[model samples]
Target: MENARRTTLADVARAAGTTVPTVSKVLGGRSDVSAGTRTRVMRVVAELGYRGRAGRAVPPDAGRPPFVDLVLSGIEGTWANRALSGVERAAADAGVEVVVSVTRPPDDAWLTRLLARRLRGAVLALVDTTPDQLATLAAARMPVVLLDPVRQPPGTVPSVGAANWAGGRAAAEHLLALGHRRLGVLAGQRTHLYSQARVDGFRSAVTQAGLDLADDRVVHTDWRRAPSRARAAELLRGADGPTAVFACSDAIALGVYDAAAELGLRIPQDLSVVGFDDLPEAEWATPALTTVHQPIAEMGGAALRMLLRLGTDQPPEAPREELATRLVVRGSTAAAP
Candidate 1:
């Protein structure tokens, strides 16, 4: 039997006839390595089976770069994935390395540690951090960017987000144009600023059209599938319920669709529905879903850029950025009964 090539660090070290630690140190890029020793060790490594870390193998770029940190919530969600991709792309273009941490509501100890370490920049993805957390972030003197609007007054910190209000208005206008006079609104969590903005915009357009928005017509939901579906089921089964529904999110709209089916109502013919957030699944739903499209990718990119700028100076600049939204008409809506 033939023996396999017995490649070992000793073999390479022997080829150079140097100490084992010298070869190991040179391969590890230890600064103590003499130039002549480094060249010899590298030559032996090329002749042997040894490989170095890829990042070390690549030559360093010549430029001054900024460091960024991204603190996101719910990394598993579809929307969060899309937003993260955008942020990564922007950070790469700026030659900044982004250190990311997943953050949750009501706890900020992790943030305090990161701040104590003195990072160059940080961004908060659409998470509900407490006012105390915001104050802590401010006191830490890190340049912070809020992903979605917070309950705090405007101009508190730089924020870049979708024009949720415009999205709401667009959704309402689409339904109204379809002759949907009697409407039902399924709102998301009231604590969420974007959700509240959407609800207010919908209500504004509905009232402007001279339609009476009865107290019963609007329902507050937690934006989860089971609860929203249960609430929608009740509304659909009622005798005087709305002929049209405007759900604040695609998740809520899905519940409405399920509820309408349980009540034996056909979309468009018997009930019209409009939704916010044109998620990928929106178009694939039965009868399709008419919805408002927010520029989710652009929102993420803008937030990253804004945070990068803020890191240079920690002054409290309330930069309010609004990305445009559009109405997408699909098969789910039609003239009201």
Candidate 2:
């Protein structure tokens, strides 16, 4: 007996007068489809006897795997590793798999790849989604959750992040408590929301403590070790250099360490230092960096859970979730000498 032809997603889409991704979304139980379109797709699916895979009749959950995509611009350091670990743990607990993708400025080809895979949802780490991309995902019924977004997303999009402002304030307050009146700040790029918030919070704390942070004391640099180190050396080599410095990130803090060494200054003795994002490298530093614990792993886990909720057609309690930040006092900071 001859084997019967199997119905495919493309065939269903053609019959429904829609695209493959739309049909995939309809079969995947995505909530982004309009009611009318969903109904039409369903009718077409039934009429076509569309078997999702392996020539089997379409099961309720047949179109896509029970997995979500964890997308990042780059995964080069401890921060990304910690986040990815958390996501993996959470996904395993939920009996779901995670697919990690590193894409810079995700384009239509990326979207096409995702649609082809029929991914359930996505967790974006420092990855900005454009309007066209968002619309495409919506049409395909794929949900997305942003974790530590570089830029603030639309109000409707759900996001999970650390309390950057509070973390900055805490860092400043720690330095102030140590009697460091002359403070220097290595701020990240102003275009990034988190970077701006951290800078604002540090300024607020400094101003409230009756100290002036001169423009010369605050230098904006790309959040990289090299640039940060260069800026730190410049700030420290000045005529009236600060006794204490707060770096916006641990990576930048590493720069501060290099700069201090180059200047023959001892950490916490001649130059107290603090950094944000208590990455593992912070603890391993010679003086164990005094830094803000931003809960990078927790943020990742939270973002994954939020995406799962979205995939289930459930609305999140809040559009934005800010995890708490705390100060981890280590050997790098001390009283002004």
Candidate 3:
């Protein structure tokens, strides 16, 4: 009952002006105590951070090695799986454990639960962080590293990502080299930093080739396939639709394929397609997708390593590190018809 490290029922009893037995009885769901006394003790137990018999039975940090949270915006597709694998592998090598969670940004429920636990740090993948959230983590001294954050994070936070702009330019240059003057772009959410970076790079390349985005097609849509398909199909319906299209993600590229199929357009022959991320499924497509290879797993590992350094009171090698991205040529694109 004498817990020096944390609050105990004895401490709760003194604070609540009651006896330890009564506090214990209330926690145990016993009905012997008067309602008024039980209510006050229960409130004090919550305030004092005293858990019942289960919590007091063992030390909170005892026998449990430190772990980091691998928080994902959502486990949407292969990207999340690959990111998780990379972090898990790196954590395993570093003698740390990974606790994965799917959470939404600006939500305090996850923050409250996270703050209550004993975690080394957290790696947020494709998640947005608010000023308040960053302040809370800073106040709690919980280290964090952003992995391809949806938006640009504050300069103070460390972040890891692939070279999105270069990847976009590479995709654009590839299409342009293949004799395609008219190009199209299927971008993710308009506010997504990576998405916009890719689009900007793509435009820069096309402009360097004496083409203008004003004459090209650019559709900003959801990162998933269904919405992309609808948008791409509509764009393709135009008489001057692009001969080649650059999709910001592999998922969106697949949707373009669906659109092409719906419209009876042949890959590379009728319409050339290029995608980003170069996910596993890209190779198995009807005509293997020519895409930009973003080191998704490597980014996760980098974030994990950065978080570990921060947890150890060491500064990261850099505030933001972007791994190189390269274009992978395949069957999806060809010289314009």
- TM-scores, all candidates, are 0.77, 0.79, 0.80
Q: If ranked by lDDT, best first, what sequence of candidates would result?
A: 3, 2, 1
Question: Each model's number of backbone clashes?
Answer: 0, 0, 0
Which tens-of-lDDT digit does each residue in 1-337 have in candidate 2? 9997776778878888899998776655556777667667766754664545432212227544486889887889888999999898988888788998887552324444555554667888887666545544544455788899888776657899999999999999999988999899998887888988998899899999988888888888988899889999998996579999999999999999999999999998999999999999999999999999999999999999888777423243437889999999999999999
Task: Tell me model 2's lDDT, rounded to 2 decimals.
Answer: 0.81
Q: State the lDDT of candidate 3 residue by residue for 1-337, as single tens digits.
A: 8657866668889998999887656544355778678557656654664544322321237667788999888997899999999999999999899998878654434554565557888898987766555544543455789999888777667899999999999999999889998789999999999999999999999899998886338988999988999999987886788889999999999999999999989998999999999899899898999999999999999999988887423243437889999999999999999
Task: Give the TM-score ranking, best first.
Answer: 3, 2, 1
Worst 10 residues of 3 by lDDT: 51-60
Instruction: Report the lDDT tens digits of candidate 1 across residue range 151-200.
Output: 54335678888888888888888888888887888888878888889988
- TM-score of model 1 relative to the true fold? 0.77
**Candidate that would win on TM-score:** 3
Off by more than 4 A, model 3: 1-63, 312-318
Worst 10 residues of 1 by lDDT: 51-60
Query: Could you give me the TM-score of model 2 versus the true structure?
Result: 0.79
